[model samples]
Target chain A: MEISDTELMLLGLVAEMPRHGYELEQVIVHRAMREWTAIGFSSIYFLLGKLQKRGLIRAYTSRASNRTKAQIPGADSQISDQESEPNTKPRKVFTVSKKGMRILKNQALRSLREISAHYSSLTRGLLQWPFLSREEALAALQDRLEALRSEEDRLSGLQLDQQPLPDYENAMYDFALSQIESEYEWVKRTAEYMETKPWN
Target chain B: MEISDTELMLLGLVAEMPRHGYELEQVIVHRAMREWTAIGFSSIYFLLGKLQKRGLIRAYTSRASNRTKAQIPGADSQISDQESEPNTKPRKVFTVSKKGMRILKNQALRSLREISAHYSSLTRGLLQWPFLSREEALAALQDRLEALRSEEDRLSGLQLDQQPLPDYENAMYDFALSQIESEYEWVKRTAEYMETKPWN
Candidate 1:
C-alpha cells in the first residue's frame, strides 16, 4: 500500500490514541504545527473514510455519550430503536488495525534507512579528496551545459500562436524557466572559473 | 497550475507535437528513459483527459483509411453505404494551448528560483560559524534527549498492547523517532567535543 505523507501522519496520530475525527484534526493542526504538517478538517474526514475502506482502521461509537443522553427523557425517547443502523451524527472513534501498524513500521524503517544512506553518500562525496582528472571534470561540465541548452531551447519555443498566457499561470511557468536559466548561467560561470584555476 | 513533475514532463512532450495517446506513451517510455519521467499508459490517457478538461489541450481526429469489403459489386455498394456514416476510429490529437505554455513557463521559472535559493541557503549555513553558546547547546541537547526518552516510553507501552500493528507502518514511526534520538545523541557528542577542544 503506497501511502502519502498525510496518511503516514494520520497513522501516527491514530497509533497515539483512538481519537474522533474532530480531535484528530485539532492534534494535527495545533500540536504538529512546527513539523509543517497542515491537514484540513475535511481532509481528516476524507482520509478517515479512505482508511476505513482499506480496512487499515476500524471505527466504533463510544457509549459514554449515550449514557449522558439517556439521563434526559426526550433524548431516550427520540433514540432510534434499530441497533444495526449507523447513527447519522454519532462521533466515530478510530483505531489502527494490525495490518495498518505493520505498514507504518515498514515504511518508517525504509524511510530512515534511505535517509541514512543519502546522508552518508553526501558526506562521502563532499569530503573526498580530488580524484577526477581535469579532462573528466571538463567532460562532465560540458555534458551538463548541453543538457541545460536543450532544456532552454525546449522552454523558449513553448509559446503557442504568439498569444500571451493568462497572468497567474504564465507567471508561474516564466518563473520556473527563469530559475532554470539562472542555474545554467551559474554552471557556465563555474566552468569558466575552473578553467582559470591553477589546479586545472 | 502547480503541476507535478510527471505532469510537467507529459506537458512538455505534448507541447512538442500533436500525437495520439499510444504514441505519446511510447515517446515517454523509450526515448526519454534517461529523463526518469516514466509514466504508465493509463496515466497518459488520464492526463490527456484532464488536460482536455482544463482547456490546456485540444484533441482532433485523423482521417480514416480506405478499404473495400470484398471484390464483389453488391458488397462494394453495401460498403459505400456504411462509409457514408464514416467508419472512422477516433484518434485523439493533442495540442498545447496558450494557457498551457504560460503555465509551463511559470513552473519552470519557479523551480529555478527555489532550487537556487535552497542551494545558496545550504552553502551559507554550512560555511557559517556556530553561534550558539555552550550552555545553550547543552540545554538544547538535554531537552531533545528528554523528548526522545518520553517518545521511547510511549512506544514501549504501545508494544505491550494486545492489538498487533502492520510491520511497515510501525517501522516508519519507529524509524522517525529513532532518527530524532540519533540526532540528539550526535548533538550531545558534538557539544562535548567542542568543549574539550583547545582555543586557537
Candidate 2:
C-alpha cells in the first residue's frame, strides 16, 4: 500500500486503542509524533477519515469528555480540551479493523526490515567534503555541532514540560534523544578529525 | 530550485572537475555513490542533459581514450569502457558553469542546514507496542535484530570487495557501516527492553 508515514503511524495508534479524534490528538502529542513527522493536531481527523475510507480502520461513536471513565492507560497524558469539557455530544472513535491490523503488520515489516539511514543531506554534505577547503569543511562541521547541541537542549526542554510521564511515553522521547546524541557524538568526532587532518 | 539529491550530487561532482559521461560514472562508482543514491551507470548521461538544460552545466566534446591526456585525477579508478578503448567516438564532457557553481553552493547549504533522523518505522513500531502482545512485540524485535545483524554482514562484505582503497575513498563505506552499527545497537537495546518488560 502507498500509505504515508503519517497514515501508517495513525493506523498503529488506532490499532492500539479505539480513540476519538481529540483523544487521538492527545496520544499523538503524548507520543511526540511531531518530532519525526509533520503530523499536526488538526490533521488527525483527516487521516482517520482517509484510513477508514481505505477499510484499514472502522469508526464508531462514543460519549465525550470522559476518557478517564474509558480507563485510558495514560490518563495523565491525555490533554484534549474536549476530553475535559462538560456534556459534549458523542464523538467518532476509531478502531483498527482486521484489514487494518493485517496491513499494519505488512507496512510495519516493510518499514522495520528496510533499515535505511534516510538522513541523506548529511551524507551528501560529507561525501562532498572534497569540494570544501580545509577551513570551510572545519567551519561546516562546527556549524553542524552547534545545531545538534541546541537541538539536544530543545528536546530536554520538551521533556521538562511533560513531567511525570509514563514509562512508554518517556521511551518515545528517550529514543529521539538517543538518536540525536548518537549523531552529536559522530559529528563531534568528525570535527575533531577535520581539525587535526589537512584536506585541501 | 527544488533539486533532488541526485541533481545536487551531480552538481557537486561536475563543479569539482570537468568530466565526460564515462569518466563521471567511474568517479561515482569509485566514491561508492550507489550506496546512498540510485544513480545508475545509464543515468549519468540523462542527468548531464538535465543539468545542461538548467545552464548549471555545460557540455564539450573530448575524444575517448584520452582522459590521461586530460590529466584526470585518480586515473586508475576510471572504469568506463569508452574511456579505455582506443579510437572511440568523441564523448560529451561536462563542466560546471558559473551559474552551476553558484547554485551548487546554495543547494549544498540548504542540504547541510537540515538534519532529520529519518528512521521512522522503528519508532513507529515502538509506539505501537500496545497493539501487539508482549510475545508478539518480542518476536517482532527479535526479527528486527536478525535483519540488522545480516545488514551488518552485508555492509562488511561490500567494504571487503573494494580492497586497497584510499582513506577518503573508504570513508563512504565507513559511514555506511557506522550507520548500520548504530541501528544495530539501538535495535539490540530495544529487544532487551522488550524482553524484560511486559505490555498488555
User: Number of the top candidate by TM-score?
Assistant: 2
lDDT of 1 by residue, B108-127 (tens): 43432232111111111111
What are the runs in model 2 whose C-alpha is more than 4 Å off? Answer: A1-4, A16-31, A38-50, A59-94, A109-114, B1-3, B19-31, B38-50, B60-93, B109-114
CA lDDT scores, all candidates in order = 0.52, 0.72
Docking class of 1: incorrect
Query: Fnat of candidate 2, please?
Result: 0.25
Tell me which residue pairs clash in candidate 2.
none
> What is each candidate's DockQ, to 2 decimals?
0.02, 0.26
List, residue by residue over B84-111, the lDDT tens digit for candidate 2: 5663467788899988887777666655
> How many steric clashes between backbone atoms does each model show?
39, 0
TM-score of chain A of 1: 0.46
Give candidate 2's error at residue A55 in angstroms. Answer: 2.1
TM value for model 2: 0.73
